[model samples]
Target chain A: MANIKIIQGDFQQRLKLQFAPGIKAGFPSPADDYSHETLDFNRDLILNPEATFYGKVEGDSMIEAGICDGDIAVIDRSIEPRDGDVVVGYINDEFTIKYLDLRHRKDGYIELRPANNDFKPIRIREDDDFEVWGVVVWTIKNWRKY
Target chain B: MYGIIDCDNCYVSCERVFRPDLKDKPVVVLSNNDGCVVARSNEAKKMGIKAGTPYFQLAEQFPNQKIAVFSSNYELYGELTGRVVEIIRQEAPAYFRYSIDECFVCFDGFADTNLKEWGENLHKRILRSVGMPVSIGIAPTKTLAKMASHFAKKYEGYRHCCMIDTDEKRIKALKLYPIGEVWGIGRRYAARLEALGVKTAFDLANHNETWVKATFNNIVIERTWRELNGIDCVPNEEMAKKKSICTSRSFNGMITDLDGLRTHVSNHAARCAEKLRQQGTVATIVGVFLNTNAFREDLPQRCSFQETLLTNPSNSTITIVKAANEVLQKLYRQGYHYKKAGVIVMGIGPDSPYQPDLFDFNAEQFEKMKRLDAVVDRINKVNGTASIVLGSQQYTRKNGKGKADVVARSARRDACQSKNAIKQDFKSKNPTTRWSDIITLK
Candidate 1:
């Protein structure tokens, strides 16, 4: 079975890292401000803390969308799932990581397009069991781990 | 206007979220221990499958129909409910979670925006996000919003979102709505109202307020009547901290041993303490109760209840579980087959700046317990339920043999490590909360 590990990210103890404005590879500049305002990753990445969830991508269906296998997809249910939005959706009782195509102008139907050309797009009928689980707000790619 | 979003067939919907094939089918969710039908889908209701019908009687009720029956999976339901609540929290300016399946939202600043359209969007969002069908009712009062939600669910013309905006619409909706179906009006009041010629919500609303108050002599009824008349009498801040929290469940089978009963009681106590901490409250009294199978006429009947008052109010699971076990010892009967057990924490108060006992206060132990609880709660929050449980709660028959064996220091560690300690055979994967249970695409 393909596994999608969901780890609840802690928002309480947020790490605020100080970043130099422009790091010069040649030499360290003394003119640069020593004490820069700390940037909170939780605040910058997560728009809605309560509604946000982390789902580990299991398949390469949305590889073209930068959500490759083993990547962590940050889903935000609070955000409206719009056309062209990459969404975690349920189709025929199974969940899929796909891009929602609502521009077809079809009544009571929408297309779930897989990013990889190898996979065919799923045309969901109104009567068919389908649901857009949440909109993928951010994708964290693990270059080393994968 | 106030808007109330209520999930249609909440438990069944929660079940259907994982099993889409059960959609439009005769599906019913059984209560704990696979007892009775606690929740039924619309199709099941249409097929005359009544709620509260015993699971065993399903075959007799609908012999030929292939009914999809599932044991109640509260972990999944709770996680999904939290997700829905989170969405509502972000959408509404101000909101109150009235129940697991219902929430009351105030659109205070969105008066200029079309409320009907807004309600529709809210419904669609929830349906899409959580796979739970919710009906939205927008009205001037919470009670009316509830009534409007009933109409939204019952009739397809409303398109899952009904708004009672104008006086004309209110009057029309209320006239069609029976007095019994009104928010706070129960069967007793409905019968009384009917006798007094108040057959519908419209009739009750049109009645003289002073006369109705005098007749009922009840504040809630008076408020309901006022609310029906478009006066928002019910306070929006109705979600108050609970005074008492009780956690109880029926066993899968009758537990004859005291150790088994202790394990269940400790679990309940731990849950109660966790709840108290969630609300930032401490309980002064801890109560435990155990009862033999009431349904079995052949077995000996025994039921016992015991409670103890603590010198210091505490929300620590260790303290509560220790106290609960003491009460459980008092309640436990050797021969009786105990089918159910419960733990109730009462006389709850705010936990901030706890007043220590003058003579018997252990500052070091109190701080230690607080830290212990916080760590356990945090771990459990991130890593599913019961990842780390009290050793006392893990004393099962298969592993520890009995309470006497579990009391041994060496045996306690072994019991805690046992996989069969916490029974969760009926528990569904907590898709939203647990890492392992998250839906995977292949």
Candidate 2:
């Protein structure tokens, strides 16, 4: 027998969208039987609220990665970043978002590979005063702005 | 055993959360109204920037230095520190926040756990999750734990967590610790102790209980002596909670009129009530204090404080504000330039289970006020703060239109800025709290 487990998200936070405040408390409504909680973005999306932060992308360095300018990136600082993960790093006294390349760690350095061809990958030496600020979890796109 | 985790240079570290580039650089956070330096980074301290140095004196004291100065941005600090507290809530088996930057973790059930490793891992978790570095100290007593935290911060060899478990280790640490630096020992007591040749913590701890009582005749000093000797005597501060909550700040400038004083006092009282509601407590005594600038030697100076008792212990903003304003009326004096005003609420207790006064307790009205407060708090929380504030809480700042409007940080940036315009010119961006102020990644 094969034991397979599918991820099931159980959102414990329920928002009663069908009801309004100041309704008379006597005689429960028949609508109560069909009441279902509305979806909550905070509960469903943010796995770790304490470690979450938002940063706005400024340029096309990550355009090829579907992370573009004017997009909002959700970063999680608590996660231990891994190879090939889109991470936010502090380089040249500015925050840079790129794919972390750990393939060259055996040679005493790693690279932050940019998605677009116009930008060069940032090479960080073993002794560089650098750290992965956070791992990019989600990038929000504004489809139509009024 | 008890462990104390304290944030290193709390305000400076909070400012550095958004400005990652400022790490390992000279940074200082000024107090309210940018009056004086309240917190300094390690680099700034190395550059001889002393605490309480006025904002105007920084350039004069250290000429041509690249020092980053920031006005106190408590909104950013509160949000970042809340995240740290959330992390601590998950990591420690049992913990209580002592202050905005300090938390105490109790190891009552875990006898076999490695306390030092636990502290180190907790520090690492908080540092990564919140970007706020903390030093952990573990000892049998809270006082000793606080001292251990100091050693952990001073010496890199300790690796941000120092534990004093053995008697020999405790004795050695106390011998090296200064008496003035001991927790619960105020500056006056430290000075008096120094005069008696008690320079080191070991000297005070070495004295018998009889000598400590005979010389000092103080319970706090005796408790400090016992804590230094590794006996858990000092009570847990968080369990007791804050005895009194005072919401006070110096005016943007000198205010001479009673109307000006009324406006400021109302805001402070409202803030105190909001804080009380948040803490799920009520205050019975509401007090107001006003003072003239002590530095202005040319002008007449007067300072007065008056308090009034409430008919019923309450956390209602209107009730507290009304009581505070009545006290302010009695304390205000003519012909004095007032520099600061504050509202303090004392005799706090749990909001529920209070014996309401038999004469004034109105159940219907009390319930109405509670519901009203709940709605107001919800509205403010959803729509930024001060959206539904009392009219009296509005500052008497006249805009170009000469019409009164609510002055709050979330509502209008410039309107609130006009209060401390010059001093807050160097205030940093509140990236964590505001959406538009989030960092830009290039």
Candidate 3:
């Protein structure tokens, strides 16, 4: 089946009838702790002076490396990823995170390995088919008192 | 000595990876079958939400409190746990991953140094790097270390690590603790221990080893006794090689048709085989089963089990799946609304086991299988699972029911199939954040 989507204003009246009270109350506003500072959307997008951009982590491939889903990642595009350094790479436009393998193959190729054994290692053909977006400089993860 | 380092409230910690706001919230992770609670955060425990309590039951009990209920996001937990293990390996002298949320570390010698300090440093490093809170316990034996770790979990003053190097500390802690709460003492064993007047760790430890072993039916109780006395009884674990692997689940809708049941079994077999190849293991026996709901009184449930032995142990998905299907056929009977179907692989060993029937015509089939497995594995590794899949899983819920590539691609497939795929590792105070991929469905 195709992805499910409903047109805006398509069910405004029906939704209003079903959830009018909830609509008036609005979502239980998250506490100040849950509310993140709003990003300056109007600010001109700019990479760091040293070629870094903070991107939100979307998947768990790098969770083993301590970079978890939804965590903010510090990506340094300028610094070449060394062995064991986690990197965000683009393979055919799909973003992936893995440890960069510097071991030279017979054809002098490189492979990206996920920290978790559950994920298979990715071998990059010597032919320039992949792009290393940036090396991971740091990870911002959640911390809370027990 | 060998020690198991386990995280407290691992799932909740993973969730905190992103939503730091959920720190100290009543959080619980549901079991694989969406059946009951498996892991609970400290806050959840404080709320009296017991582990294995049914989610629906808990919801009824505490409908007002905003308890965070989450499905098991193993992908994220596995990833986070991996990071923790890697960091431990880098810091510790030697270590082996004991389970998804546990590891065994060898901490010997250096009495002059503070073991608690080492543990604090390790915990801080993991939190800084992986974003998870881990409790460490140092004792002379692995079993005692496990107990110490358990003590560390409940006591906030221990600074996330507990060591019971002396008998006084062990005895003091044990007097107040229930005997059933001890590791390796399950409900039945704990009841028996209590009946025998062994009501606490100290009580159990004080018992004669021979009597305890005789009462417990094995050497496990004796080992526990020694561990309590600070005698190193548990051996250092090299690696736990899986003897068998299984894949099973209760259907969202009960399946009564044999064909539908077969398809479900096939799906599980395919998954089990994927796990097999991932672990470099092969199976010699395939077991299949189908059963009706045991709780439902309206229908009488019939259950059947059958197994097939292979001439050659193989990691080939097709080989095992085909065998599992045959077993399913033998076991599946009509007129019964089967609530569950499952596949079990036994006699598992290294993948390169020799084939006894080398001259069989299927030798050519094996060659094709080798190539096919490699190609499928490669493509799925990149594009995600069901980038390719056996056509059999596509039939009607039985005739391969629920087989449409669409439903499979959208929600259910993402929930069921992606588990063994897109593996990522990380650790966090919030288990939900780590397993966000698996929870994305919710």
RMSD of each: 6.6, 4.7, 20.6
List chain B TM-scores, each candidate.
0.86, 0.94, 0.83
> Candidate 1 regions off by >4 Å?
A1-146, B107-113, B166-175, B178-219, B222-226, B229-231, B236-238, B304-306, B353-365, B403-427
| DockQ (CA atoms), all models | 0.30, 0.67, 0.02
Q: List interface RMSDs for the candidates, in order.
A: 3.1, 1.0, 12.2
Tens-digit per-residue lDDT, B398-422, candidate 3 = 2232546435344334534432221
CAPRI band of model 3? incorrect
lDDT at residue A16 of model 3 (Cα atoms): 26
Sorting all predicted structures by lDDT, with the top scorer first, yields 2, 1, 3
Against the true structure, whose lDDT is highest?
2
Better of 1 and 3 by TM-score: 1
Task: Report the error of model 3 at residue A96, Å.
Answer: 23
For candidate 3, state the interface root-mean-square deviation in angstroms to 1 decimal.
12.2
Error of 1 at B316 (Å): 2.1
The candidate that wins on DockQ is 2
Error of 2 at A82 (Å): 1.9
Candidate 1 lDDT, B317-366, residue by residue in tens = 99999999998887776788888899999999889787799898999998
lDDT of 2 at B106: 83
Error of 1 at B403 (Å): 4.4
Q: Between which residue pairs do clashes occur in model 2?
A: none
